[model samples]
Target: LAKTTQPISMDSYEGQEVNITCSHNNIATNDYITWYQQFPSQGPRFIIQGYKTKVTNEVASLFIPADRKSSTLSLPRVSLSDTAVYYCLVGDLNRDDKIIFGKGTRLHILP
Candidate 1:
């Protein structure tokens, strides 16, 4: 399995762009990087995903380099309501392997 590393916590203010980077040293070619965001008392929701290069959605953008060793999840103009925990998942969806989740990065959006 590919391991992910992220900061334990982050602090940002309203209307700020926050980028959380996740490192996966042993990521495989078929593994896709996926980002999820979870609120204090809610389930995690998919933010963005990418195999290579960059992928963007209304909520966020995912950037993966050619090496695929690391990925960055960018949240544009985040607000106080964006406070939550973000997780990075690296896995092959076509496989039946178990999913392992690393300790998520806690994000605090200030007023």
Candidate 2:
């Protein structure tokens, strides 16, 4: 599995957008970059994923560099309820993986 590093925290005002980036310089060929969002008590939920190029869903957009060494997750027009922890993981999604969550990027939204 490829190792990933992410920022510890970020602050944003309500109605503004947020973008969080992760680094994985040693990413493997079979690895895929995945992003998950977590609230205070809920388990992390998949936000978006990609092997290359850009992928967007109703919630967020994931942009991956050509070399796959880094990825950025963009949250559009965030509100106070959007405050949460964001995590990045690099590995095969179909495999029995035990991903260790980092302290993660704590997104704080102010009204």
Candidate 3:
């Protein structure tokens, strides 16, 4: 598993776009960059994932650079309800590896 680094917290106003970046200096070729969002007492919800370049879903977009050392999760027009802890994970999903989650970035959507 590739260790990831993210901000401890972030703040954004309603209707504004938020981009949370994650750094994985030792990413492997088979590793995939995955983002998750978790509210209080709830399990982390999948946001997006990408191997390289860019990938987008209805909820958010994921951007991975050429080196694959870093990735960004972009949320468009956030609301107060969007506040949550966002996690960035890098690993091979195909394998049965234990998922180790670090302290994720806490996003605060302000009014």
Candidate 4:
């Protein structure tokens, strides 16, 4: 698994768009980028994933650059209830790889 670099914290008001970027400069060809969100005292939940280009789900959109070294998770119209920690991870999911959770970016959504 490749270590990811992300902002420590971010803030946005309700109804604003929030984009969190993660850098995986040493990502391998088989690596995939995944994002997760966790609320206080709750387990983390999967948000989105992508190998290259864009991937969108019901909750968010993931955009990976052609270089496959970085990705951005886009959250639209975030509300106060959307406040949580967001994690960006990279690894070869095809293999028996263990996904390690790190200190993710804390997103604060203001009213």
Q: Candidate 4's residue-wise lDDT over 1-111, tens digit each?
A: 688899999999999999999989988888888899999899989899899999988889999989988899999999999899999998886787887666899999988
TM-scores, one per candidate: 0.97, 0.92, 0.96, 0.94
Q: Over the stretch 1-111, how does candidate 2's per-residue lDDT look in tens digits? A: 577889898999988879899999988787888899899899899899888999999999999989999999999999988899999988875676665566689999999
* Top candidate (lDDT): 3
Model 1 residue 29 CA deviation (Å) reads 1.2
Clashing pairs in 3: none
Per-candidate clash tally: 0, 0, 0, 0
Write out the backbone clash pairs for model 4.
Answer: none
In order, what lDDT does every prediction score?
0.91, 0.88, 0.93, 0.90
Alpha-carbon lDDT of model 1: 0.91
Rank order by TM-score, top first?
A: 1, 3, 4, 2
TM-score of 3: 0.96
Please write out the lDDT profile of model 3 over residues 58-81, one tens digit for every residue: 999999999999999999999999
Instruction: Give the candidates in order of lDDT, highest first.
Output: 3, 1, 4, 2
Question: Which segments of model 4 are wrong by more than 4 Å?
Answer: none
List runs of model 2 lying over 4 Å from the truth.
94-98
